[model samples]
Target chain A: MAKIRGSIVVDVERCKGCEVCMVTCPTGTIAMAKEVNHKGYFYAFPANPDLCIGCANCAMVCPDGVITVYKTKI
Target chain B: MTEATGIKEIIKPENLVYKRTKIMTDNVLSYCPGCGHGTAHRILAEIIEEEGIQSQTIGISPVGCSVLLYNFLDIDWQEAAHGRAPALATAIKRLLPDKFVFTYQGDGDLAAIGTAETIHACNRGENILIIFINNGIYGMTGGQMAPTTLVGMKSSTSPYGRDVKLMGNPLKMTEIVATLPGTYYVTRQSVHTAANVKKTKKAMRKAIQYQKLNKGTCFIEIVSNCPSNWKMTPVESNKWMEANMFPFYPLGDLKVPAEETTK
Candidate 1:
């Protein structure tokens, strides 16, 4: 069966660490980082990158529109 | 190099799927982290872009949390006094009948300070869109109780939770406007999740489409959350909104233009 490979670029400084995308992701691919960004907020990162399906759920619900998604078929 | 490095190669321009809409400027939003205003602004920009109305759209921003709305979207904007956005929208639309006019207002500005203007605009059936954001508190002004604040819900003025005996019941603005003969379309929506975001986008698209018909007022009430003022994490605020806000301001269309009945 073919699989989808997904990746995302998070603008760390622009991200306000709302974590809205973390709760909104379907495959549990995102998580908050233990290290804070320059703004002292725990930014979101692709914790389970391989599990990403590139549905764009994180980007869709991100209040700041900071996450950009890329996907390919394998 | 590890296999992970090979996977990173897929992050190329060709595979890009989603990016910020060009309609929005690069300015960082002034809204508190996790506030609904950002998402709402994004959705509004997306709708205007999808309709190819960027050059023709004029947004009337109110004097509350989203007072700086003009800085975010790349469109013509007019800043209105507290609770008077609807009045501005009415005049602008009448003067320029061909342009797409909409007002973005919060609960404190709409349901409270601008109630008279809001009612008359809807009552007269002005051909314009009114985007009302109901967060139930004055988020920008230190969380004072708003007209739409839930009964028994706490605010700075009602620290013990809003008491109906003193503060009065929450205003159902959408329902109130739906009854006006001039309001052709009225719907209540939210942007808390993916499904809801999609639904709201559709609702807005229809409202925009109705604009060309010169129909009555198009009012969309977006029941939103204020995480910073509510003192909860962004995710928690959504859950609280679902439990408390949804019960009072249920999501769905209060009215929609008739398919063949209008033309």
Candidate 2:
């Protein structure tokens, strides 16, 4: 299978650390960052980027619209 | 082939899988950390933008936590009095029959105070869409008991748990409106999970499309969560909603036009 690379951009300040994305990511790629953002909430980040298929499930369920996803086949 | 920087490659139009819809304004949402209102707002905005109805769509919202929806959704909006969104929507749809009109309202504003307007609008068969958010409690009023508060559910006013005999049962407003002859379509949905959000968005899109068809009232009730008001974390609130709200307000279409009922 061709390697599928996925990346996401998190608007940290806009994230409320609700973790809805963490649960929605099908590949289990998302995790809460240890450090809090300016809003004092631990934001979501791609903890296992290699496993991501960029299905955009997290972005679909995100209430804050803080995460943007991109994907490419390498 | 030349190697492309990560930023350069990701910025390409085809590589972008998801981005915030432009229908939403730059203003940050005022909803609490895990409030479902923000998700609902985004779905509506996205649908409007996708359908190319931004120029001709008008939204009306009643007084409640979602009253600030106009601030988040970048479109023409009218603020209606508490529980009067349906009334406002009816007038707007009537005066400007060509425009798409919809009302976004909460349980407190819809089932409780605006019950008359809601029923009358549907009963009259007004060509409009009504987006009802049922979170069980009056989230904006410090989590007071709402008309849709489930039996035995605890709220500020019902801290000891709701008493069915004393306070009455949770009103199934969606089902009630579904029976009206004027309603062309009626369904209940949620946004807790990705699948559910997609389903809700489809429902909203259908409602808007029906509005353009000059069909009667299309009512979509979203069983949402209020993490702050529910005194639960965002995740826990979703779990609680699934366990409680879903049972009382089961999802799926409650009513559909006769012609489309078979499929």
Candidate 3:
């Protein structure tokens, strides 16, 4: 079956790592990176990229403009 | 894909589901982690950019935690004295009636020092929009008790928790503004959740649309969170706000012009 593929790019340094994105993502595609960024805060990254639906819910809820989402049909 | 090739493919607009609005500057937000002000600012910028009104908007910045709004939004902005954003916005809107004029203010700035200015501007029916960020305490001044601070809410000034008899009660400024004849639309909203964000954005757009129609004043109060001052983690602060603030402030439109009101 054809599916919708989505990807998200996180600006590691720009993220304050508040985890709003992790909570807002519908598909549980985001997770906090184990390693810290230059600012010494754990940043969010797409952990299960294949599950992303590109709803942009994380970007909408993000206090800082850290997450950008892209979508394509597969 | 190679870096350059991938960049070229990504640049194709069709794949873009979401991108940061250009209305916001590249300057990193100075707000504390989990503060709702940044989310509010992004929503405002997104609406302005989507409406293509970037060139026709003028924002008035107040003296508070949101004072740096001018630095974040890449629009012509005027920094007003503490609580004087409405006065400045009034003048700007009068002179440039064609432009979309609005003020971004904090609870301390709008409901306290600028109370009179806020009341009179709405009373006089100024054709402008007012975005009020009510976090219940003075976030910029180390979380002092604000006019909107909930009863029993502890702050720097009310260390023992707000005593209603001693400190008075939290002001419902949005309700007060709705009573004025000059206000065309008045609503209380928040950015705590995706559904709430959508509502807040809709309120913002409606306020701006009414301003274009030369309708009377539009007031939108956003019940936000101040995690740093609240002494809670970002997640905990949101939870605290939902549990505490919403009961005292509540959400939804208090008033709307007859034209917008449905039978």
Candidate 4:
């Protein structure tokens, strides 16, 4: 079994909201959170952890290099 | 007994066949052997290296064989959805403003599925560089019908030979896209032969340089060849492109700014 750690979080300050990472994730785990950050920038949030196939697409498409998904194989 | 090694006999530290820093990632390229994409990739890298733009450059990887460009481009790259490289380029260039943004796209990826994105990107006057590889067939997807596939060429999707009545004529994208008011520089080049490859590298460098100047959309369309999919050896594919696609697409710069234009 594989365990995912350090959830994929989008830094609102850095994210341009291109939505490219959302489209590339194969697992459909990430979503644009309804709540906006203090800067009013809508950040992409990981909605479902179990669905994440850990493709690293979010990391790849984040132009600002803001998203990071930490995983652990137990 | 070891004889005195001459300069010719010296092993010379097993001269690296491939440079580690040149590759985008250590992951082996998934392209077929003798693929022209390799040539295009090398030339782009050389330009980035020569101009010292690797740090300031942002590349949009397309959805064809070059889709995995992040594996070899050795710079910041974004993998765009199928046919969306141009759109991604537009967005990145608009947002970053300072970075050198370019999109690498194949024939089917650019001329077919992404035609709208490609055309609109140029029409909108986006200050971005577009490297369009028109190999006349979809090399990555098992040689399917591509927008630029020669009239008589046969592919997996058109195994009966491309019939004009059914498949439509091959698209002259460079000529079509050159007409866009936003496109400041448009050239159709090739990498079929050494001479052609050199010319292509020059055109590619020019396009990238145009982007650095904040020039409007500059498009360099390489009328490349897919030997593996064309069912011909590398030599034969070169001959075929020269014979068939060259007259159709032609090789030359279509538009240059008036000041930069030679009198």
Which lDDT value does model 1 have at A17? Answer: 96
B1-263 per-residue lDDT for model 4 (tens digits): 23223211221333211121343344445565346676677667767887888889999999888888888778998999999998889989999999999999998888888999999999998999999988888887789989888788899988998899998998888888889999999887776454566787788787777777887999988877777788885556667888987888888889878788766
Candidate no. 1 TM-score: 0.96
Score residue B233 of candidate 3 by CA lDDT: 85
Docking class for candidate 4: incorrect
TM-score of 2: 0.96
RMSD of 4: 17.6
Residue-level lDDT of model 4, residues A3-74, one tens digit each, is 432235455655444454566577788877787766565667777755654455565434334554544332
What DockQ class does candidate 3 belong to?
medium
Model 2 residue A1 CA deviation (Å) reads 3.0
Off by over 4 Å in 3: B1-12
TM-score, per-candidate, Cα-based:
0.96, 0.96, 0.95, 0.71
Q: What is the descending lDDT order?
A: 1, 3, 2, 4
Q: Which ten residues in a row are the worst by lDDT in model 4 chain B? A: B11-20
Q: Tell me the spans in candidate 1 whose CA falls farther than 4 Å from its real position.
A: B1-6, B260-263
DockQ of 1: 0.81
TM-score of chain A of 1: 0.96
For model 4, what is the C-alpha lDDT against the true structure? 0.73
Candidate 1 clash pair list? none
* Interface DockQ per candidate: 0.81, 0.64, 0.59, 0.01
| lDDT, candidate 3, B44-99, per-residue tens | 99999988899999999999998889999999999999999999999999999999
lDDT of 4 at B62: 90
- RMSD in Å for model 1: 1.7
Model 3, TM vs. native: 0.95
